[model samples]
Target: MAHTIDISVVPPPLKSDWNPPAPSGNSVSPLVERRLLPAGPAYLAHVKRAVHKLTFEEHDKHVEAENERLGLNGTGANGEDDLGVGDEEEPEDLLTLDAKEWKKQDHYAVLGLSHLRYKATDDQIKIAHRKKVLKHHPDKKAGIAGDSNDDGFFKCIQKAMEVLTNPERRRQFDSVDPHYEDLESEVPTEKQIKNTKDPQFFFKNFAPVFEREARFSRKQPVPMLGAYDASKQEVEGFYDFWYNFDSWRSFEYLDKEINEGSDNRDDKRYTEKKNKSERARRKKEDTARLRGIVDLALAADPRIKRIKQEEKEAREAKKKGKTGAANGLSAKQKEEEEKKKAKEEAKRKEEEDTIARAEAKKAKAAAANAAKKARRAARATEDGTPA
Candidate 1:
């Protein structure tokens, strides 16, 4: 037996235009009439004047039919199969495209042009856009090229016009254009570094590594390298920046075990210990790897030696010019010079003393740790437990 519950409907006190209108013989309803477009063979023509979205069946049927016509086995269309199988070009043209890679295709390809993207004048691009608009526009699609192609490709052409026509968007697109070949890889690889020529090429090509690392931090951006003619301070700063590079890499994802649900305290502690050791090891490896790269760059650099020699030559020239001159060092100047030399000597001695103390301290700590370990081992032996 079926149980039924009484449901009551309440009418509003006042009927406004917000309420649905009474049923009508008219095919288009009055209430949502503004939300729709004029009746067309395809529904999307008047709404957004863009691509017609197809249901799974409709899309599949279209693809299957196209495959049959092109004598393809439905893997996907290839350029050999048809002139419109543009998918292969997209990946080859963009290796590091951010998102929706298929959607952000080559604007030139979208407009069905070649070799004129960066060189094409705005008027020429506009003219080409208009011609394409006239050719494949949905308004003219029916009866002209009916069912031969969807509105998607034409919409891409329209989008290409918008992107290629605007100066700023065009600049951004061009920056990531795979054809630029400014740096062959998104991040410099070992091969790229080995193949790189001089400091200029090294600085520019290695920038992508810093850029990749930059996404790890909010406070820092990748440091721009100084030119070979940079001032002493700027050169020092560039070196210091790389020397103190803080990588944001972590090995948390590589944990052998995770302390998730159903783990006891011992299990949790074991997992934590494993993760800690792994993180420390990874950090050490990263620091050493970075230091090695920086060292390689420094050794390969041709500027540092020149800068030092230039400074030395300037000092020697000044000394020779000043010797026995009317403005030669006074007695007071001589005293000040002696004091400065003495102060520098004292500072050097102090730094040496500090280094010696640090080394001694480290040695002492190691000795203490060794003694402690030995004692622990002895105790473990006495207790008959694993050391």
Candidate 2:
């Protein structure tokens, strides 16, 4: 007799309903395209999906526990209240109180100025912020405000300052702010109208302030290539733009070479890749070298002999200037000043030598002319009986 065998049915694991957002068009950099594309988009997408799944799972667990504790059966969890649950059946008004507290602490509303105002004049805002800090700094108000633990409030202030100061970050913050929602319903101010409508007017009003803050932060200004006219008068900033391109291209080429090893020795594709890689590497090194040179020049490149001379001079000058030489003339400064002075002296001496050569040539020419004239006169006297 044949025995009947039973097979247990196994089901496939559940597929994730969630999908990661597509990469923004601007997110793809040329460097990324060249170097990272070979790694494959699927690998990146897989990692992103895994992370999202994990995050969603955690959020779901937290929400389920919160709902169970709150006794809000069948109600969806909305992140409206920080205190998600109450011990007993809580009044609806208590739920609203938490939301009210959150609303009261709206950072954007406290700093009621528009994005344009902040962007147009960061210094003025900074000054205003400094004043507000002095006035509302939890430490200063601790005795009156009754909150001895004011660190959280101070932290909030700092966070607000940081957000408002950054352009991209401020734009993001403005978009999410309750005030942004109200802006559409409210009448636009004359200043707001002008900023929105007139690009030139806006730039004129804001660029100086933005530039000043950027300079203070030690940032380089954005280049405007089209603004320059080569056909007109000599451009002041042409060399800077040229150097920037050189530095960027060289760096790009060098980096590629380092990361991607050389293997295809005879291939045109390989050669181009190698060229790009080396160029990038060399550019970085050159930029670093240039920065070092600038620092050395600033320190007044000094020689040992010049350093001794400068130290001696500084001591003498200090006596007359009424400044303390011991404090003023550090070893580094003395060396730098000496080297600078030596270089200047060498240049001066070279110029003097050139001048002396020119003068000697003129004198020799004059003497030669006189000698030739004398010789000719003597010859005429010898030839003629009229001597």
Candidate 3:
């Protein structure tokens, strides 16, 4: 007997909101939920989807917080305004500088390192250059009123950077630094030193002069011009050092400008030749000037006079001692005299022996020459040649 199915009475339809019964206790973890999902590009796409979108208000708040943290709106963590580095006002004349006359421009000033000058380090130069570029770049002044397309000052800054960044070029520029030249000129002349009545004139004036000049010396730890009461050796050593001073300072900075755009090798050669000659002339003049300074210092030095007087006194004392010894001879003195006489006699004998040897050598040489001549004559006679 087959069971009759109740097809007419179907089970009530399940509710639309019906879900599976909750498992054991807590909710599924994100890791477990991801693992349970189907693996493929669909999973990756779902993982990459944004979980939440920031409202406009939240984004503005975030930007404000970042700006405050970074000090972009001025007042940094250090309580100082972000005014930037190298904000010093440039001179009007400097701004009007011609790029073509870059050699005449103060490179340090152009880089805003005028105060530091040659003392500015490589890093300082780079910082200064960056600052100047930010301040004076043509693009920065593109639409400014009264600012023409003149990038002359900008070009000058570039030239200054080119010089200061290169060790050799920086040195060349430093060699003829105009401010230092002015300082050198201010050093008292020989005539001025001679005329000065102040007792501390030499130390007050010459000390600073030497200190300034010592910067150019190839050899460091330069001996200084010491105080007035310096010992004879000290004074002498100072003079000796200056007299032999090997200066690294050169005159290339003062070289005449070569004709630009000229392809003539002869013009270049001529310019180089003229520059070299000028350098040599200046070097010679500088040496002579240094020598003159030394001479003046020596002449004016009271220590030199004192040393001379002391030497003279020592000689006189020594002469007096000799005179006293000669006047009265003790037994020991007599013995010493005899020994001295013997020494003199020995020295005389040696001199006579040396002279005898020299004479014998000369005679031997003469005899050899005569023998050679005789042999030559004999040979000539044997060969019936002119004797």
Using all chains and alpha carbons, the TM-scores for the candidates as numbered come to 0.34, 0.20, 0.59
lDDT (Cα, tens digit) per residue for candidate 2, span 186-285? 3223446344654344334333322322221222454322221232222224224423433211122122222356465566576677777666565466
lDDT of 1: 0.63
Q: Write the per-residue lDDT of candidate 1 for residues 155-207, one digit (tens) a residue.
A: 66767788788876675465444343333235455666678665577667555
TM-score of 2: 0.20
Which ten contiguous residues of candidate 1 have the minimum total lDDT?
Answer: 81-90
Sorted by TM-score (best first), the order is 3, 1, 2
Go through the candidates in order and give each one's C-alpha lDDT: 0.63, 0.48, 0.80
The residue pairs in collision within model 3 are none
Native-to-model Cα distance after best TM-score fit, residue 382 in candidate 1, in Å: 99
The residue ranges of model 2 lying beyond 4 angstroms of the native Cα positions read 1-108, 112-120, 144-151, 185-387
**Residue 62 CA displacement from its true place in model 3, Å:** 32
- Model 3 RMSD in angstroms: 26.8
Clashes of each: 0, 14, 0
Task: Write the residue-wise lDDT of candidate 3 on 1-387 in tens digits.
Answer: 899877687799999999999778876766643346468955544443433355556655766786676675435346654443344577688789989888888888887777778878777777777778877899887878995534898899899989888999888888788878878666667787778899888778778878878888999899998886788888888998998989888898889889889999999999999999999998888778777777777777767877889889999999999988877667678889999999999999999999999999999999999999999999999999899
**Number of the predicted model whose lDDT against the real structure is largest:** 3
| TM-score of model 3 (CA atoms) | 0.59
lDDT of 1 at 135: 60
